[model samples]
Target: MKFSQSIFLPIAAIALTLSSASFADNNQRRIDIDSKVVTEHKAKINNQRFSYTVATGTQPVWDDKGDAIATLQYTYYTRDKVDDRAKRPLLISFNGGPGSASVWMHLAYTGPRVLKIDDEGYPIQPYGVKDNPYSVLDIADIVYVNPVNTGYSRVVEDKDGKLLSKAEQKEQFFGVKADIKYLAEWLNTFVNRNERWRSPKFLIGESYGTTRVSGLAHELQNSQWMYINGVVLVSPTDIGIKRDGPIKAANRLPYFAATAWYHKALNANLQAKDLDELLPEVEQFTINELIPALAKGGFIADDEKRRIIKKMAQYAGLSETFVEQNNLDIPTQFFWKELLRDRGQMVGRLDSRYLGIDKRDAGESPDYWAELTSWLHSFTPAINHYLREELNYKTDIKYNLFGNVHPWDRSGNNTGENLRLAMAQNPYLKVMIQSGYYDGATNYFDAKYTLWQLDPSGKMQDRLSFKGYRSGHMMYLRHADLESSNTDLREFIKAALPKEGQAAKY
Candidate 1:
């Protein structure tokens, strides 16, 4: 529900209309669930030129009876002529949306190809991809995965050539646990078939995919006996970490300050300070002063309550009266709408740097998301062009950009604990979190909180690290972040790998 604003938009009116012929092709021209289309390519990454083979294909997800129920589409990139690939690391990448396709990271971030967007992360007229010199391919092979109902991934027909009922499909692949379970099994098959069981493996996920990979970290280890070396969470979700009401409310202040600072809406003194200088002060106040004040609720004295409101208003770039009117708790939507109300504009939920105009300037929230539309304008066309024209994987089946994967069961979400448990079991496992300061959807402060709570015993603290960017949810979209983020990943991968004679013991 936290990520529903960006990933889980309503799709009741759009009919699925997925044809069975798309899957059961006899001509061998169209792609099927059990198909593999290999292509060769070259790219210059990190100033180093190299050729790599891209194996774009669909792998089946089998049921308990060993029957294929669904297929997941994936693109794997491995450097060419690597005689000792067993020592090379493989990075398995996923984008969040519970229902959104993997195209975001596939075309924008760590992929060898990047969308032709501007340096500041805006769409351009010519929608296509260019060589990503910052891609981490120089150090590690990468694979981008599209889960069920996303991208070209779809439900498979039964042995009788009939699609399974809608109810059955949801039961198998449309929930937190269900998603983790099937993907782990599918990964086991992928590792075995590729003969890379000895290769060091890593998992990287964004947004809701963070939840998916966090769960998968434990699921793959415990269920399939697949041990991974590292886990990277980009613009992470709560991963089932519990935050009480007052704590949640107090945690939002630093994000408000960051967004306000980006818009130049903060007070003159606060606005003059750099983001790095400003955030720590706000963060200190939020933890030491605000959280306790909020917990007192109506029991606090009037003078104390008034003092808290003034500071909240000052930090959030809102009027004292407005902060007081909201009972000292501001909803993110309301902040998005009210931030630029006088200018007749609204900030984006995912990336506040993008602005939107509402039908009326008096609304509580904007009419639609500004950042998502901007993202689609570029990503949709570039991915379509790159996959078909460059990669040469052709198919008539329409790619579901943001698939209809709702009625998504969010129960039993203990994935945060699962990651901790997984780390406790595997001493070699390490984690790195990347978050954007301007990402209102999954605020950077909450990401820090999630990491802090991930291992309460503090034993795994040394294995964990956090990195912050100045952009939003998809931080790599910005040209500056693209370079630095990949560099961080390169460093993380190298550090997480064990020394030649090192043991896997604490």
Candidate 2:
């Protein structure tokens, strides 16, 4: 799961309401009999005003296993300003975690408004958010959705609640495939209801949501009929969790080192200015250097082993002796715990921006990352205000945007297999990836490593490009960094569109 979600931006004003609870005289359906304003909120950023709406789900969405949930949504719309039907793209976006809502992305990127971030990396303490003049809403119609159980999107039930199934439940919708599949169906229904069927469509997902899009791209193609032209994956990680089988996993150590180096926590030096440049070196070293050394084991000649280990030590930014001590295999969790361990500090496994020291000599990891604290409760109001006051959707339940992973229900995957499926089906579809140097969870290395996994033609590979920034997973919280990402994303979007001679403009 992501450490936090992007913020949910609303288009205009804010108001929330709750109706009288009324059941359909059955356990399956619970409808509120009456409705009234429950709450309202708003934000103004960069001289623009954004609003949100909050409501409860009057009807139960499910009752399989988990808890009965409800739903809440944030919407943004631009009428005349949006590109005409010929050019407009209706982009639906969300974060992963199957448990997370759209807050992090909404607050950080894509939304018409953004929550200001403090130097330590979180929405400001006074709780102020504002309109984003840089918002892509000027070009496309966008909505940040929280799934059935994450954010305020929930399901309320009488028997066992609307939720069904649990972890490793790969066969149930509660997992990966089901959540996205349902979203697709619901979205299709929503579009048909709203008359947006003709608009071009796009999906922007981060982390697990990247995995979600990998499948959604295919689903939208084969069954959904919402043909998509572009997908922007921010730090993808849908391949089988273990990478290579368990035993050979040690061979991929350079990736962890590269991740550490990007965070500036590693001492090893390779001649590359940033992650984008260093990736090739790491990939090469992993093949020509580290892989060979690992194969030799203790039987390898001493000088050759020494040469590789020294390079490894420098590349990994760990003490040469320490590298030798561990036999060149530093586990991911250990690296996370050790990089700053000596200083009695630890960097977050989720978002590297959070740094903490062990409170005791026992070397315990911090209770939570700094950003996690901000995600705890700050986003509810943002969604609430956006829903009722602006786009004016009505409901009466909490939106469950984040929840436990129910694999049984997951639609497809973020694996190399699925990405290729999407690309192969839509040869012209373009992929753009953005990574954050400080994102240890879905490190940039993982995305770069996927090059070998994909079987696309050389031309397709050539068309793929990636960008890495100095910030963490939700990097946009950093204003200047956001401007840089925005500029590049906009340029890429223009080039990928159907236009033949359009200049890449932001």
Candidate 3:
């Protein structure tokens, strides 16, 4: 899974005390299925009163030969009193971790209720959740799915009641192709079981989930015969050309400038300009001067290299001498540490506005990411409480918020190519890409570069739209960005709707 630098942390083993007797008896193992919980609720969103039904449970995932392999946990919210199911749209959502639960997006902004964090997205003690007035529930019915091994989802025993070993389970759903295959199958099962085949289907994925949706789009259309109407990507990664050489460094320049501007570290003239204006200038410099200079390397004249370094310092908010000493290549980690080193602090790689106090001020990297810790503290407890208390779902299993599913096989994982193919196969498919200005994980500029590469002919440009937020990776954590994102999504969904008498047929 592609993650932001800060999001990937050490995985502590969850204590699951299973008896030796139970482990020894393979035939005694049986499939455990939780009862589905259904509740009716009403909320006033955007000043409009809406009633919806919330269903929380697990759906069985079956293999090709009619054998159950995994059970995926999900929370589905469907608006009540919708006469024609065919007319309403259905959105399937998930977050990335390759092992992350869907709780972040579910409880933060997309679901009917959102966790009550501070305006700046910092956690408040005694974490609580309330009706999210900006939720997308008003526009479409949503299903927040926690992929296998995350949340309450788990691999199950075979039809013969024989449990598969951990290695076997990993072989089934831990790789890029296997993950998409199972998810696509699970989606098919859900839509069929719920009688939502005629409804226009859409997908919303964040971070690595973006990569999942891009690949799933093609997989669904080609393998499962399921055509989707739209896909909404938040903090997308793996869409652009591989981040290496001068391209990688070039893609990061805008983020550096944004980080510098946020900290007021840029030169007086650059700092005086509005972010909208300053970013374009930085982007121009990166493409016209910085990229070319980096490509030429030592072949470039000494004077030109010196001039480029000085200009880079002006935009990146670093000293000319410091930039020169590094040979004009400043990685993101170094920038995070060096940006605020003078004050004995480090900026967060996930969100540059967040400041952290390092144990040692002279280190190349901070000890930990303050922003990630802050979010985990709030989200972890809030999700647990909401699931048990309000949702009425009972589970003794420790929810795997971010499981240890690393060393993931990335072979044949060209999601950008998959997206392009999906678009070509289904010309009516629309896409929306959302990015946060302060997100160092997947830079907004890098996403744009990926889009540029996706549509070289510009024929599908009108169907593709981009929205920017003034927040970080989890942009919706900020209330204002949440509102803005919800509004833009509402518009995008409306625009993506089929024209009069042109509804899609599955």
Candidate 4:
């Protein structure tokens, strides 16, 4: 799980509250809810001027008995004077970190204003924000949603206006199934309230957000009768924990080669080739040699083992002896440290192009990811400024950019299965998976493996497509990749929508 800043409250203080009858009856209590804050704004996309409305606020989630259980916070942007909801698409976007807020996706790429940073996404002194000419607002109405407990979203107070205890809040909204249940309910409420029943709905999620969207597609279909047109997965990580063996190791080979190629750590022949040229050779080697060799385990001959070690060293930028010592399988974490150990530095797991200095270079993992630090530095303040100063939505609660949703229950959930079922149920539902070539966290090849596992028959293969960027997990942090990604997504959205006369298939 991603490390995030959190506030820890003593369990003893809330122990009595947990035992009290008042706490038990709190769910039965009724409370008056407030309306969301809506504001108007103007922006230019593709050098064309357009006016939009920014609605920043929370929507109450009510239970079957009509009591408010939780409130989900969102920043919604809709084009003004667009009367035909059926023609305009609505894209609901979110970030990962089971605990992360939606601010990363909101301010960094999809929203009207984007954070200003260096070309490679490093933080610049005197941080600034700029208008995003590639904003999706030109084609789709965007709603950036923060799951309950992230951003300004929280559980509704009791009739007497008393907030629930931390334990109670966790019980309500912190697990896999629980999260899907509540988010599906919240989306249903938002659609009914906004009268977006006819809009071509799409979901865009990054990292764990991809996991959420996968399950959400199924849940929304069954529970809310909501069928989506498309889903955009950014740096997806839906491979289940049970499937982590030789296949996982094999899947990571291309990523290791890509990272080594980026830092010029590969052999002279590999170094001379571009990343595009080097990765295909590594991927072929992985399937034809590495997976079979690793699957053989101790039974392989010594010469064969030596040959595998040499090839691994060639692709992974490690010594033959080091690769042999690790049983010819170099885990990604070890590669992070080993690849640049001679230079007294460690490469980042999120983005291998990012280098960081460790206190001691002998450790298995780097001290921290430099890219994550750069992201937090730029996104945190930018979101706070946008919410309060620009949109004028004031709140005393500290925005949970990254909250404490640890011990996250990851049980009995497979979004790939959900994705498959959704596509089978709704034939027109298309999927677009985007990945960063330099990202070590969720390798592009691994994402391909996951998608391959989903569709073995090639029947729905045409419905799925992929695009790779020369970036890390958050590819949009870089300018060139951001522009390319916007264009790619725009084309995908246009293709996924129904034709003018034909009704939405969903």
Going through the candidates in the order shown, the clash numbers are: 0, 85, 0, 0
Indicate the residue-level lDDT of 388 in model 1.
Answer: 74
Q: Candidate 2 at 92: error in angstroms? A: 1.2
Q: Residue-wise lDDT of candidate 3 within 149-267, one digit each (tens)? A: 78888777664656667687777788778888889988988898789998988989998899889889999999899998899999898653476788887778888899899899987
- Tens digits of per-residue lDDT, candidate 1, 1-506, equal 01011111112122121335544556543336666667677777888877888877777888898877788889898898888989999999988888989999888999888889999899998788888888899999998889998999988776676777878878888999999999999999888878788899999999999999999999999999999999999999999999869888888899999999999999899999999999999999999999999999889889999999999999999999899888888999999999899999999989999999999999788899999999999999998897776676777778888887888989999999999999999999999999999899999999999999999999889999999999999999999999999999999999999999899887
Model 1 steric clash pairs: none
How far does residue 149 in candidate 2 sit from its true spot (Å)?
0.8
List the candidates' TM-scores in order. 0.94, 0.76, 0.92, 0.91
**Residue 75 of model 1, lDDT score:** 89
Task: Tell me which of candidates 3 and 4 scores higher on lDDT.
Answer: 3
Candidate 4 matches the true fold with a TM-score of 0.91
Q: Which candidate is the best by TM-score?
A: 1
Question: Which candidate order results from sorting by TM-score in descending order?
Answer: 1, 3, 4, 2
Error of 2 at 281 (Å): 4.0
Q: Which RMSD values do the candidates have, in order?
A: 6.6, 6.9, 6.7, 6.9
Better model by lDDT: candidate 1 vs candidate 4: 1
